[model samples]
Target: MRDVLGKLGAFAGALLAVAGVIAVASFVIGLLSGRVSFGGLLVAVVGAALIAGVARLGKVPSLLGGYSALVYLGLFLPIVIVVIYAFNSGRYVTVWGGFSTASFSRALHDDAITSSILRSFRIGLTTSIVSTLLGTAAALALARARAGVRTPAEVVILLTVVVPEVVIAIATLIFFVNVGFELGTTTMFLGHCVFNVSLVTLIVRARFLSMGDSLEEASRDLGAGPISTFWQVTLPRLAPAILAGGLLAFTFSFDDVVISNFTSGAGHETWPLHILSALRFGLTPTLNAAATLMIGVTLVGLALAALALRIGSRQGAADFSTSTT
Candidate 1:
């Protein structure tokens, strides 16, 4: 009887969730179609309430189901707003004069904007790859090193995160000047690498620490060479963390304004820099379109990274627990 009740409660919750999703989808569709109504929103709210009530019946603790619904809505609301505004046919960014694709068309056709976007992409991709490699190696080295050596290295790695980004930018600028190097995409790539490497290191290090050394040691004991063990055993386990860190680095590089400002040369503006410059003259619908695209890309990258980390960390924990048992 208890099992049947629990199953029924969960099924009821699932049905409510489906209804809420349908209602939300209808509301979004209404926005795009210029037919937004209060009815869809009311249905969504009622569905959410029913879902939460069902969750309570199913033994979920602390109103977690309700909190989860709210949290997801909060996170996605801004994106939806930006997307809706991106299609605005107005000269101003925020005003909803009408629905049109002119903003996207204008943004896509602008050579300066497109070029800056391409440059940012190149810098971001290169930085992500290089930083991930360097950071992952450093993390592995630290994990395998003696405590005395690891302590100082860990401190150095963390200092970049603790220091102000402007300080790092200034230092990078001065260093480049001292070395007689010109500021450009190369300089921007290098500057981004400095910060991103630290970020990757932190993420990969946590993954490494959680994974522990048991599997690696076992591989070696079973007559595998260190290179082989790392390639076959360690790399596979670390793949998700590396990918997550790389995506994070790419996102950071793409969104950067302050550091890129110091490192970018004359006539070599990144997308963020371009957007900032445009904002000086007040925001436009075209700018909103560009920003909306950027936000979409960034959110996708972050979502993927978060999913990778979550899955990888959970799998690692399960493996470790099973091994110990």
Candidate 2:
């Protein structure tokens, strides 16, 4: 009897979730059509309440699944809109201008956009390199340090990451100004490296800690010097983590707007800065095309990072298994 009730509760929760989704979709459509959707909103709210109540009755998985779907939808909906409207035939981004790829052509032909893109890429590349090298060194040092030193160092490093980015940006800007440094691409690059080094350090440190020093010991035992062992054994194993961290740093630098805004002095613009400046005038499909292209690049970078991490994990497991055998 309890099983039957549980099954029935699950079914009811599923129905409520479905109804809520349909109502939300209708609400969105009505909003797009320039109409207020009070009735649809009410239905969605009521459906959500019902689902929650069912969840309290032990249908939690169904409720959680629906919630997860909603969360993802909220997160990706705007990105989906931007990508879809990139091809809009209309000049403005919001209106349905029919499907056309002219915006992409315009974006490509625009010198300002192209130049900003190149500048961003250069800054991102430079930031990634600096972050990777410094972060790797920090990770190596921390791993060998005493607990007292490691704890303090880790707290300092994490503080750089956990502190608000706006604060970092403002602090970096003030410091540069006080030091009489010119704000330009160089400043922007330095600002990015500040936090990115911490990010890369955490990633590499995690990988380094998980990767035991047995392999390095083996190489040393076979008459390999520290430098030789690091080059031959340590580097090969650590490459995936380094690559993943670098890719992530590059992506963060590429997408950053706050630091770039604060540090990029007059006359120097990255792609994100360019987009912000363009937005003051109005939304254009060309901007949408550019954003869509950036989204594609970001997605590719993230995918590659995830793949590298997965590969590293698998390789580590294989190596551990071989050593144990």
Candidate 3:
């Protein structure tokens, strides 16, 4: 009993000693030469110490899990902030003078912003549709083609997908400059399409591989033509995956900044471009509100899609079983 008590006491004392040292160090550094505010430095030191303790524990505790939850929140929090601030009567990003809908009313009335938003939506839709169609077709072709041909095509597609966006953006810029092509929405559209194709192909290929060939064969036995079988049999099965993949592609195009930064033609501003330009002026809760709204929209879309897919899948399985038995 004595031995156990001594060991516990010593461990506790050592831990306290280490914590005290950390507290003292934090104070000294925070007060040093006015490089950092005392409050800010204290926050930083405490944050580091907490992170170090978590690392030393060698496992994710409930507290750590809560921290992980913060990632999801952080991704979305800004959007909520943006939406709320959009309605703020304040014209500027800062100084929330009063709660008013003047900003939203102003935003709605701004023809330029509205037009840009519409153009962005159009680009996203077109990109998603084009990328998904081409990608799914390529995936199907790869699955059915001779190994030699498929191998080369797959390699090309994989390379296109894996290449860094910066490289693609720079290359696009160079080509446009060389060709004397005026930057416009078209360039942005083409740039997005190029990147999206690879993403779409990978997603569709996974679905294709997982879906064995037997079902298609069975459809052929039922007197369905190749085209009919594809539309009726193959397509229905792939629809969920296609929609999911397309949504992913759309979301990507909607949020893309790096590619847009280089490809978007002058005078044709996008939401992201506007945001980037605005940041140079100053940071404000206005951005935060916009971010919050975007997060909400994305979550709502994903949730609706997931629910629809669940329902469709359950119905599909039931129908398949009934037909088989």
- TM accuracy, model 2: 0.79
Q: What C-alpha lDDT does candidate 3 achieve relative to the native structure?
A: 0.74
Q: Which stretches of candidate 2 lie over 4 Å from their true place?
A: 1-49, 52-58, 300-325
- 97-147, model 2: which lDDT tens digit per residue? 688888999998999999999999999999999999999889878876899
- Per-model lDDT: 0.84, 0.86, 0.74
Give, for candidate 2, the lowest lDDT window spanning 10 residues.
Answer: 50-59
Worst 10 residues of 3 by lDDT: 58-67
Choose the strongest candidate by lDDT. Answer: 2
Query: Per-candidate TM vs. native?
Result: 0.72, 0.79, 0.74
Task: Give candidate 3 regions above 4 Å deviation.
Answer: 1-64, 70-76, 87-96, 144-146, 221-225, 283-296
* RMSD of each predicted structure: 10.5, 6.7, 7.5
lDDT of 1 by residue, 177-274 (tens): 89999999999999999889989998998899899899899999999998999898999888888888998899899889989999897989999999
Best candidate (score: TM-score)? 2
lDDT of residue 238 for candidate 2: 86
Greater TM-score among 1 and 3 belongs to: 3
